[model samples]
Target: MPRQLLTDELWEKLKIIMLKMGIYDKPCLRKTVEGIFYRLRVGCPWRDLPTAFGNWNAVYKRFNDWSRKEKLMGIFNALVVDPDLEWEFIDGSIVKAHQHNSGAACEQETAIGKSVAGNTSKIHMAVDACGLPIHFSVTGGEVHDCKEAPKLVAELPKGDYIVADRGYDSEALRLQIKDKGAVPVIPRKKNSTRGNDEMDWCLYKYRHLVENVFARLKHFRAIATRYDKLKRNFEGSIALACGLLWLPM
Candidate 1:
C-alpha cells in the first residue's frame, strides 16, 4: 500500500518534539528519524521502508534506540490531544503473539497469556469519544477483560462516564468504577439475578466506539501481529499508533 508522508507542519512539529526529547543529538539525521516514524505509523516492516526516507538500517537503529530509552512513549503522551468531554470507553483486544516476539523466551512466563485463540497477549485500552486513547495496559491473553478494568479505569480522569460490556459485569468492578466517581454503564450478565441493578441499553450502543477504535488500531499491520521482541517496544508501537490516530486526518 502507498503511504502518506507527514505534512511540512506536522514534520516541523515532530522535529520540535524530537529536539525537546533529545533525539536529534545523535548521528541520526532528520530524514532517518522521519523515515523510522513513517514506517511505525504505516505499520510496514523496516526493510520495506521507502528509500526516500534514507537508509533503512539507519532508521531502524534510531527506532530501536528510542524504544530502549522510552522516548517514543514520551513523544506519544506529549502529542496526544486531551479529550474534550468527560466520558470514556474501556475494552481489551487480543493480538496473536509471533515467534519473533519470543526474544524474552526466558521471561516467557511474564509475556505469554491465554486467550480464546490459545496463547496471545491482551491490550487493555481506554479511549475517549473522539477515539483518542487515554490509558492502556498489557497482560497475557488468559487474563479476563474484567481483570484489567480497574487499572485501565484508574488511569482515567475521575468522574468520567466509563462505558463497558456485559463481560465487565461484576460487583467489584462496578464498585471500583463508582469509587472513582465514574458511572459504570456495563450491562448485567444474563445469569445475574439481581433485581435492583439495570443497564441503559441506549448507552450500551455507544460502546461500539471502543470496538471501532480497536479496528483502526489493527489497521497498522505491525500492531496486528507482534514483531518487536521486547514488551516495551511492543507497547511503544501501540502508543505510537494511538498518537497517529489522534493526529488530525
Candidate 2:
C-alpha cells in the first residue's frame, strides 16, 4: 500500500469538519478522504486509486458527490480563519490542462480555454497579509488578470489595502477597491494618460506573498496541472489544498 497523506493529527482536524458537514456515516472516513487526496497529490486517474484506500469507484463517487454538492468547499471554509483585514494581495496563475482531463459532457462551462500554452485554466485568488488565501475564482486561461480583479476584490472581507502587480493596473479597479474603503497599492502603467495612483511601494512588496501561496498550492500535483474536466471538481481540488494549508495552523 502507498503511504498515507492523512496523518493522525491532520485526520483529527479533517474528521471533525467532515462529521459536522455530514460527509458520510461509514467508519472508514479517513481512508476515503485520503484516497481523494492521493489522486490530487499524484495527479492520477481515479480508477488508479490504491485498494488500501477502498474501491476506486466508491471513492470517486464519494468525491464526485461532494464536489457536485459543494461540500468539499464547505469543508475548506469551515476550517479557514477569519482573515486579517489589514492588507490583501491578489494575483492569478495559469495551469496547463491535461488532454485526457478534457472533453467531458457539459465541459463547455469549465474554465478550460485556448491560450499560448494550448489548453489551459487560470486560478485567480486573493490572500491576506499573512499570505494565506481568503478567496479564489477559477477561469479560462485566456482571461486577463485585470478582467478577474474586480470579482476577487469585490468578494474580499473588508480590508484596508489591496495590492497587485502591474497586470492589475487599471483606473476602474483602483476606484472599485477604493469604493470598498481599501487603498489600492497597484502600480501605475508607464504609458497610461491617467496620473499616478499614489501606491505604497513598501506595502506592495508583500504582494509576492500571494504568489507564494500559489506556489505552495501547485506543489499538489492536481493544482499544478489541470487534471479535472469539470470546473467544480477543480474548485474542490483547490479548496482541499487550501484547507490543508490551514489544518495545521
Candidate 3:
C-alpha cells in the first residue's frame, strides 16, 4: 500500500466539506481518494495504481468524472479557510510537459506551449502572508509573469499589501493593484530611474513565502511535472494538491 497522505483528523474535516459540496461520501470513498493521492504523489500512470487500492480503472474513472464535472476543484474550494489578508504574494513557475502527455487525437486545447524550454505550461499562483495558496491560474509556459499579474490579482480578496519579485514589475500592473486598494511592493526594474518607490524592503523579504508555497506544492510529483494533456486535468490535480495543503494548516 502507498503511504498515507491525509491524517484521520484532516480526513474528518475534508469529509465534512466534501459532503457539504455534494460529493456524498461512499463506502470506499476514502480508499478511492487515497488512490488518487498515491498517483499524484508518486506521479505514476493511473493503470499502475496498486492492487490494494482496488481496480485502477475505477479510481481513474472516478477522478476523470470529478475533474470533468468540476467536482474536484469544487471540493478544493470548499476546503479553503478564510486566508489572512495582511500580505499577498504572486509568482509563476514553468513545468516541462512530459512527451507522454501529448498525442490526444481530439486535443482541442492545452495550456502547453513551445519555447526554448520545449513543451511546457506555466503555473501562476498567489499565496497569503502565511504562504497558504490563495489562488492560481495555468497558462502557456511562455507567457510572461508580468502579463498575467493583473488577471491573477484582480479577483483576490483585497489585501493591505501585494508583494512580488521584479518579474512582476510593471507600471500598468502596479496601477491596477493600486486601484484595487492594495499597496504594491514590487521592485523596480534595473533600468528604471525610480528606486524603491513605495517599496517595502522589510515586507518584500517575506516574498519568499510564496516561493516556499510553490516548493511545497511541487513536492507532489504530479504538480512538479506536467503529464496531463488536458488543461482541466492538470488544474484539477493542482486543486487537489492545494486542498490537501489547506487541510494541514
Candidate 4:
C-alpha cells in the first residue's frame, strides 16, 4: 500500500466535514480521499496512483467532480470556524508549472504564465494572527501582488492590522485597508520619499507568518510545483493542504 498522509485522528475530523458535504457516505470514500491526498503529496499522475486506493480513473473523476463544484474549497472554509483576527498578513508566491500542465482546454484560465522561471502560477494569500491561512487566490505568474491584493483584502475578515511586504506598497491599497478599519503595516519602497517612519516594524516583522504558511503548504509536492492543468484543480490541491493545517486546531 502507498504511504497514507491522513492519520485516523485527522480522518475522524475530516470525515465529519465530508459527511456534511454529502460525499463521505459513498463506498470506499475514505480510500478515495486517501488517493487524492496521495496525488497531492507525491505529485504523481492520476493513472499512476497505487491500486491499493482503488481504480485510479474513478479516483480522478471523483476529485474532478469535487473540484468543479469547489467542494474542496468548501471543506477548507468549513474547517476555519474561528481565526485570530488581531493581526493578519498577506503575501504572494510563485509555483513552477510542470510541462505536464500544458494542454488544458482553457489555457487562458489555467493561471499559468511564462516568466523567467518559465511556466508559473502565483498564489496570493492572507493568514490570521496565529499564522493560519484564512484566505487566498490564484493568478498567472506574471500578475503583480498589488493586482490581486484588493480581492484578497476584501475577502479577509476585519482585523486590527494587515501586514505585507514592499511589493504591496501602494497608497491606494493603504487607503483601502484604512477604509476597512485596519492599519496597513507595509513598508514604503526604497524610492518613496515619504519613508516608513510611522510604519509598525514590530507588527510588520510578523509578516513572516504568511510566508511560513506558504512554506508549509508547499511541502505538498502538488502545491510546490503545479501538476494540475486546470486552475480549479490546482486551487483544490491548495485548499486541501490549507484545510489540513486547520485540522489540528
TM-score for all models, in order of appearance:
0.87, 0.96, 0.96, 0.97
Tens-digit lDDT track for model 1 on 121-225?
888888777667877877877888987787777777774678888779888988988998878888887777874256667777888888888898888777787
- lDDT comparing candidate 1 with the true structure: 0.75
Clashing pairs in 3: none
Model 3: per-residue Cα lDDT at residue 243: 89
Clashing pairs in 4: none
TM-score of 3: 0.96
* Model 1 pairs whose backbones collide: 114-141, 114-142
* Candidate 4: 10-residue stretch with minimal lDDT: 106-115
Provide the overall lDDT of each model, using Cα atoms, as 2-decimal numbers.
0.75, 0.88, 0.88, 0.92
Candidate 2 residues 19-123, lDDT tens each? 788876687778888899999899988888899999999899889889898998999888877778799989999999998886789734688999999999999
126: Cα error in model 2, Å: 0.8
> Any residue pairs clashing in model 2, and if so which?
none
lDDT pick, better of 3 and 4: 4
Candidate 3: where are CA atoms >4 Å away?
Answer: 105-107
* lDDT for position 234 in model 1: 76
Ranking by TM-score: 4, 3, 2, 1
